[model samples]
Target: MRTLAAFFLCVCALPLWAQEDAGALAREAGAQLEAASVRLAEAESARNRVRALTDTVHAYEAGLSAMRAGLRRAAIREAQLRAQLQARDAEIAQLVAVLQTLTPDEAPTAFLHPDGPNGTARAGMLLAELTPALNQRAAQLRKDLSDVESLRLLQEQAAAQLQTGLTEVQTARSALNQAMAERTDLPQRFSEDPVRTAILIASAETLDAFSSGLASIVEGDVGWTPPEVDDLIGEFPMPARGVILRRAGEPDAAGIARPGILLATRPGTLVSAPTAATLRYVGPLLDFGTVTILEPRPGTLIVLAGMAVSYGKTGQIIAASTPLGLMGGLPASNGPSTGGEGGGAERSETLYIEVRENNVPMDPLEWFSTEQDG
Candidate 1:
């Protein structure tokens, strides 16, 4: 009977041992699930970060594009104002011509007589009428002149603002580039997390391509040189004709250094090369809107600033007098052309010409091929 009892006790203990073993296995499985949950959370966090960074980059790029377009529009407005002023001038000239024919000499003493002195009284009355009319006409002309002046001023202000805007855009771009650099290693954090890693790679690749494209834009092509003009050995490139509204080294209203010459040119005028070589990079530059940088040979980079429009692309081949772009902004009907041989445009312009020999800035005046027309 005691042997039977012993066997029964052993059987009961076997079920309890089996239960303990099953519980231990369940705990181990739960721990693994918890670890997986933590890893998944980390992956989600990385993906969110990548998405945010990508969106920020896109936003900045869009802003830069908009700023460039705005600069172009502002330039066009300046041209339009010049045309309007010219029209007013032409009208004033016509009025002056009419006045010259109407009044050949000073009024005679007889015409001023108040008594009934034959037809002299009638002439006096006519003079009275003409006097007021002429005065009114003169006043109108003066008003028109004032308007033209104001418009011209507005154009100058706008151009300045546009330049500032361009600078801001460039600065913002630089900031974004820095931010991207700082976050360069953030993608690596996702390496162990497969889902996040995929997202990170995609975002990084997109950014990398964008940066590469920008870099390729800076590596310009050959520059064009003016034949028979050996004197412009170190000058920045310029159009064949025009004035410089803003000279290099001139401080702007805000006392900022305006680094390039702003050329004033006629609308639809052909802008030529200062020298001849291979065309290099032609694209939008920081604060310069549409620009063409020609690397004639290996060391020289001639930058054409403030294009109202662009016709070429990165790595495009161009020639001297080649139409890289239209005279951006408004082309003046009677206003000064900014792209000519003189100082910049007759109207408002902020030409930011920069000559770099092996990436170092040089004074453009040293190599100016033409006389100072401004």
Candidate 2:
């Protein structure tokens, strides 16, 4: 009976211990998930803040651009006004000189002069006209001075506004950085879910690849050109000489249509921006290692391909010729040492370039000018 009792007790304890273990794991997972959630929230918030700040900076930059334009306009207006003022001053001086040369028409003194009876009426008429003319000149001078003061005030106000906007950008950037730092603890907390974490990591990696691809397209190593119907827009720089394996809009060996030019480059060379524009998208595509889209100007899009390394972010405004990443592979040599076709192919890296106008694919070759026909 004691043995049977002992067996029952063991079975009961086993369930209790199992429940305890499950509960502990549940608690740990919950905590981890919560931490990750918080971190994600913070990251999103920081991203938002950064976006707002970027917009603010753009606004300020736009304002500054306007201010520069206004300044030019103001300068032109001021020059014209000054010219007018100078002309008026010169006229006044000339009039004053003439006045000095002429005697002020005094009431005709018949005792001192002969034939004075007819002269007084004409003299009175002349004096009336001269007095009004002198008053008008003085009023114009005052108006010109007032206008100059107003223009100066406008210039100062525009300058102050532009500066304030610039400061706001910096403030926003600092806030975003703080948020990012606070959220840095989230990844550690989520380490329990290796599968979910891997998914997230993969997604991030895909984004990075797409971003890199966008940069490689701008390098223009491919025999790139826009469609015959499109016009030249802009481009960025590329590192290491590369040959185009597949042209943009061309079919691959499997008859797969590609969106951008593909260049065989060193494996890990940095990519670069083709033009100054906002990054519209960064992510994966079928067969494409990575893809990135940039709107360099309004309605103009550039696509890059084969990018496994990228340095820019979506919605970010990158400058023309800015380094997106470094040459990402081994140095090229004369002999095909190991893996690929040409001597350069021994190191297998590629950069692809694509251009789009109004979201429609165009040839990149039309935009890029080079002494080399390639």
Candidate 3:
């Protein structure tokens, strides 16, 4: 009897703690929202408004993601507790029935054993111990039910936070775009020659050929070369906050494979430069949408394609984490998202990454840290 009670206690104990964890996660989301709010306010007078706004947008994105994760956990835990309660209905009924048999009015008879007074005394003591356990179990059931209600209410209230985050992120993105257009402080390696770039694009029939000529299009006496980043090869952060939808050479829906990685991102999500590099070329190339070809080191080219709006001009040099552009998609709606935290393509837009050495394609995954990729 004690063992069974222990099992019930164990089950009830877990979900109560899980409820706390879920609430903590939600609070973390709130903290991120506060951070975003502060950053937004700071941007109003910031010398570098673009950077400030970018930070604000990232904070908002983090907050929204945290909110979704918390809500998702709450939903799962609520479902679990509900199922456990339903499954234990019969057991609880039996427990109640047994407790009734040990009530004061019935205890006299229950304590009367065949072995006389000694046996009767022992029976009474056993009943006394078991009664408390049953009471404790009942108390836990009440708390567990309360937890379920709380979780449901938490999710309901989260709708407001989620909407606020979405709105704020959109505002930040718009501010960033405006600031970028008005800005004139970036360093340039060479003055972009559109005529030469157009000629090269028109002459080359394949992507490789076009890439090979990207350097020649913006030829200049660039005495300064970006330092080598071979040591940071496997430590490079992802250019955007997203999930890897496809790895290099992985077959897609039509069984066609490419020598690059596909990252699925949310609408209007900011894409950043993974490292300091010179933009060898920026614009449409072949079938790839807006593209940015960066030369982080000699003989190495990192190709990022498929953004709605790509930033930087050809021959420009940018620092790590500089805003490259926003991914293609409409702003998020003011409600719960259908996307399960950047899990699928339908819920996100794709970013294609291809790395090359001496114009030979290489797997992008080999360059990015896999332990952090999801």
Provide the overall lDDT of each model, using Cα atoms, as 2-decimal numbers.
0.45, 0.46, 0.78
Ranking by lDDT: 3, 2, 1
Q: The CA-based lDDT of model 3 is what?
A: 0.78
Cα lDDT of model 3 by residue, 169-245, tens digit: 77677778888888778887887777888898889887789888876776664645787798999888888878889
Prediction RMSDs, each to the true structure: 38.0, 32.1, 4.2
Cα error of candidate 3 at position 11, Å: 11
- lDDT tens digits by residue: candidate 2, 174-244: 34344433432211100123343335435544433433334323321222222332243332333223556
Q: Which ten residues in a row have the lowest lDDT in candidate 2?
A: 14-23
Residue 119 in candidate 1, Cα distance off native in Å: 42
- The number of residue pairs in model 1 that clash at the backbone is 45
- Which has the higher lDDT value, candidate number 1 or candidate number 3? 3
For model 3, state the Cα shift of residue 162 in Å: 1.3
Candidate 2 wrongly placed segments (more than 4 Å): 1-51, 87-89, 96-115, 153-161, 173-291, 294-301, 304-354, 357-374
lDDT of 1 by residue, 1-374 (tens): 23323433443342111112212222333333334334333433455443333333233223323333343444454455456557557545655664554454665652444555755566556555555665566565565455446545544544444343333323332333334334433111001233433344344443223222333323322333324434547453455345666677887788876545666653333344555544455554444576666555556666776766544444444444444444544433223322231233333443456666666566666656446232
For all predicted structures, in order, the TM-scores are: 0.35, 0.37, 0.86
